[model samples]
Target chain A: MTAENQSFQPKLSDSPLVVGNHRLSSRLIVGTGRYDTMEQMRASLEQSGSDCVTVAVRRERLYDRNGQNILDFIDLDRYTLLPNTAGCYNAKDAIRAAKLGREILRTLGNPGADWVKLEVLGDSRTLLPDPTETVVACEELVAEGFGVLCYTSDCPVTAQRLKAVGAASVMPAGSPIGSGQGLLNPNNLRIILEYLKEDDPEYPVIVDAGVGTASDVSAAFELGADGVLLNTAIAHARDPIRMSRAMQYAAMAGRDAFLAGRIPRRLYGAASSPSEGVISSRPYGTLGKGDQGNSQSGEG
Target chain B: MVEITVNGQAVNLPRPMTLEEVLKRVDVPPNYLAVEVNAEVIPREEHSSHSIGNGDELEVVTLVGGG
Candidate 1:
């Protein structure tokens, strides 16, 4: 069904996105990690037109020699920093990191941050999201008044659980993190989108990782994903700014296509047969039952 | 001889050595991150065959897993 069939057509960013009551202008989120250089990172961020960027908090006390906070590189005024528990492998660690982030924000004169990038990895090889731990953490975080942006498996069940637990948005992987695999499971992604639409039509469903190029982002948008969260694709690209712009256009195109409604696919050929006007009557090929069909055995 | 640090280890380099020569003296895994000379970050393409003189404090910030 097209969006026209629905009772309401919400704007892409109309999902009541007030993280910690801070209103965001854009639904697009970008990760501020993995760029080849700071210049490229900044350029990519500017190109993506994202209002929020994800940063990971490390337990170590290491500092760059310049005494500048690594995160300070990004202009905080322009972007809302969403500290992610990227290193956490389970619910407990991720939850603890989120709490620590809130505590750190308090000391920074910043209030408790309600927005968190909840990442609970199942395996490092594929960097797939652990549905079980993710749900556990999301439930806990949602109860704590935190708006969770859960990085989950591209599974309908996981998406349903996140939505049921009041996740601000569900972020399913396009493939694996940093794999540059690019939508390895489009079927599962479409399934998740359908599930979200049926379950909690109001909440936004975003494709988080495994996007290798602009087309990948477009593909996600085409599948009705509200937005996308990507890092490695642009960071590792030969031209980060170009890649970032490409991704931006791709997202727009995908969203536009989804809104416009894609055309249906057909199994049998349509009425326009290329050979309909041509005549060919010179074929003498046959195959026996014992043969492996070296020749056509069907009626013309 | 002037002391230069490579990945936290102090070593002696001649009065003048190109950045490239110093890299050969030290073992660093090529994976991610841009090279830095003193406080200035340098691109990877310039890393090979560049020269660094003695008494030059080079700080190479390698990018690792974050976010």
Candidate 2:
């Protein structure tokens, strides 16, 4: 007799998301902000099962000796710190922030020093990316030898432009940052994927921000997205740890579902069983909702 | 004492000192921090060798929580 079936491997987002020189098997990049406590943030990070986390560079307080640093809570050995220019509203400030972030990460001897998440906001109110400033920053960062992962609104043209400007990965926002709206326009995301991955299928396109729930992540993956980067949804949830776990599973499920492939939608019903068998005379009563006009047959 | 600008505030320093000595004024540990003097970043290894003169603007930054 053969050995008891023990060769099964659990399904997850195992296919690595290769962005620039960084490769993450988890495929979910989380942020280290908006948590009520550092302890909660640490626990959520553990539960999130993400290998990459983003942080911002800010002036280190001089006199306040409370002894609380984000690095103290994070395990630098386990997590790749992707420094972000989150609050910078212009290209010059954004570039300066990126350099500072990279220097800190480099001093820590982490590999993530090579890449930066470039976010140049147009305004503080909407928190949207300034297309002009963003492009300028991407070009400058790339020239400076930093792998730039740009965050922009869900605009296909901007996505293409970022790629054209040598961004390591183009991360388009699903909606406004922290609004919890979730992938507001998946069609735009699809078109972005098509544009960026046209000939270069392996080029990574990560959907960043405004992920309200786990379903939004699954929907993005099902729509052919390579990865998703979200912060507020998990950090600000009622139970952040559990919500982070849900997000991890959602990413895995979505990626697996995409790899497993989905069925094509048809306006007409297609029977699984043979039509000639005529099971129970087709049950011809008032058809169920959405089954109204799908009973018809023929196709070329 | 000579005055120097740090993180947008004017502070009095005992005298001209190395960038490393300038960073010692902060209460936070300098483990993962970067220093900038007059808009030029001073590499961590050179902090002890580079000098911070009077009126030099400095910025000491570290990692913070952000999305």
Candidate 3:
């Protein structure tokens, strides 16, 4: 029987997204950046319904009149903090950033913050991930006992290599960071997904960048990606709160549609109604109630 | 007087002190800050005993906003 005719429930939807040792119900991971205000960030996060949020580590304010820290605005119980090595340009710097992130999280009484989103950019022009450095850093971070979520290009070989090198999750970008290109090469992404899932169906593959709108996020889910990591798409939207809500529903709908199994395409049309059940009709020359003129005359 | 760098900024103190005392003098909240002395991470429990000498480089990092 076709999937549409089946009545089985989609177990994948009920299963939580497992990254490293942590299980999250919401697959959408949002970033705490580019928002106009901390309130907006908090509200958008709530609207997105994401359980994990990524934060960067930097020097603390020695003295501040505003008396504001990102941690103060975020509710620790609601979101799992995932620190990222965003500004690091090489493996050494990325490792240092990850270590600093771990220390910061530990100081905050969150010892489970060992999960680091390792991003080592090649250069400032393209902002593409340096695959070689990323692998090196991933291996070292994994050996150091950090749950390494290595961000890489949408190349199947690189994704496979990162996974083989002890990366808990493989995150490939749809395009350059913050470019809003929206899955520039979907076929490549599909290949990566297929290659990774070939060995382990439950291997976590997250699309980490180049998401432009709600549909972009939905498309990622429909392509069988495990999750999406986005910042500019929502944070830079004209109405961030509404966009966040849209993304939440879009991700869920896409996952459901993928699990339900889409119908195959065909070259010819197939009638939905019974072709033999039509009432008896006269020749084409005969006119009906609404057909004042010969319908066949249009063929002339 | 002894000088050491905190977050890349040179700071002078009358004498060498522990990581805990430097953090206090710099107004960094002990609970929200992490101390790395000379590129080595000092655990939270050892911050009190990790002594800071002259010309020591310390990197004090805290959680910030990111994507």
Candidate 4:
């Protein structure tokens, strides 16, 4: 549709979405990592206005010195838990973690837990997604009846491949994971969103990483992203709560602007002057003296 | 031989020793402050494994109760 001619309609509903029976009210998903304390994390989560938060699942049960379980603080009823395979390096390891996540959720009585933030990295330095292994893991997880959320490269082709492999949602990283670079390739993200929409209008595309500021989140939404997956942006912020609120507003503003159909950027500036006018150059102070440019208060 | 100082104790080890080797040799508690190697924070899961070479300055910064 042409930018000006197309009708503006909010495609997303105000209601919640049932992902494998877990209803999420907000599209934004926050992470519970890197926070200095539980109070800070809670405040940030509240400010981001997320309906869900992610947690990493390890093989063994762990407890702090106070014998407090890490999972104890998360109020599952208020927010849906998205267990991620953050440390997994390959398809097998990610899938293993996914299974463990499912089991934990099931034990907690969340049987229809199918959503996972799949991360299979090639190295620790860049934390770049290995497309080959990521696709493999996604295909397997989808086959296992899980709604796979593939955290993948920003490359449009890579995103398309993930969608083809039965990914419920394609989460393309804005930059390197956790670098907080903030929209390194906005043009590429825009292209990815356009490509995905053209292929399957119903497919959800979320901007998942390297978002450092509220403006970065807004840029993602302006490109017509379905939602955002944020962690470091809030966790590492100097004032996480304030940053969270800004992020929330940024997401909403960006979504609204996208729905408003932003005007295309023009290469050349266009003049909007009268076709025929006697353009005259007057001295700066004398221009307002005559009838042509007289002010309402003309005593002087 | 490489000179490595961990938790204020100087020790001798071969060059190119992995962090796992150093942790195994040191008497610092596993629950000590987060490990910082040359000012870069390394997650605990990586401490058991991940290699490092000589001239690498590693510091374990733990979180303490302080308002």
Off by over 4 Å in 2: A1-13, A60-66, A272-279, A283-300
What does candidate 1's lDDT look like per residue over B17-58, in tens digits?
777666554333332122456644444456665677665666
Model 2 reaches what TM-score against the true structure? 0.90
lDDT (C-alpha, whole model) for all candidates:
0.70, 0.89, 0.85, 0.72
What's the TM-score of every candidate structure?
Answer: 0.66, 0.90, 0.89, 0.69
Candidate 2: clashing pairs of residues: none
Candidate 3 backbone clash number: 0
Clashes of 1: 8
Backbone clash numbers for all candidates listed: 8, 0, 0, 3
Residue-by-residue lDDT tens digits, candidate 2, A108-200: 998999999999999888799999999999999999999999999999998899999999999999999998999899899999999999999
Recovery fraction of native interface contacts for candidate 1: 0.18
Distance (Å) between predicted and true CA of A175, model 4?
A: 0.5
lDDT of 2: 0.89
- Candidate 2 DockQ vs. native: 0.78
Question: Which of the predicted structures, 2 or 3, would earn the higher TM-score when compared with the native?
Answer: 2
Ranking by DockQ: 2, 3, 1, 4
- Model 4, position A13: C-alpha lDDT score: 49
Model number with the top lDDT: 2
Using TM-score, give the best candidate's number. Answer: 2
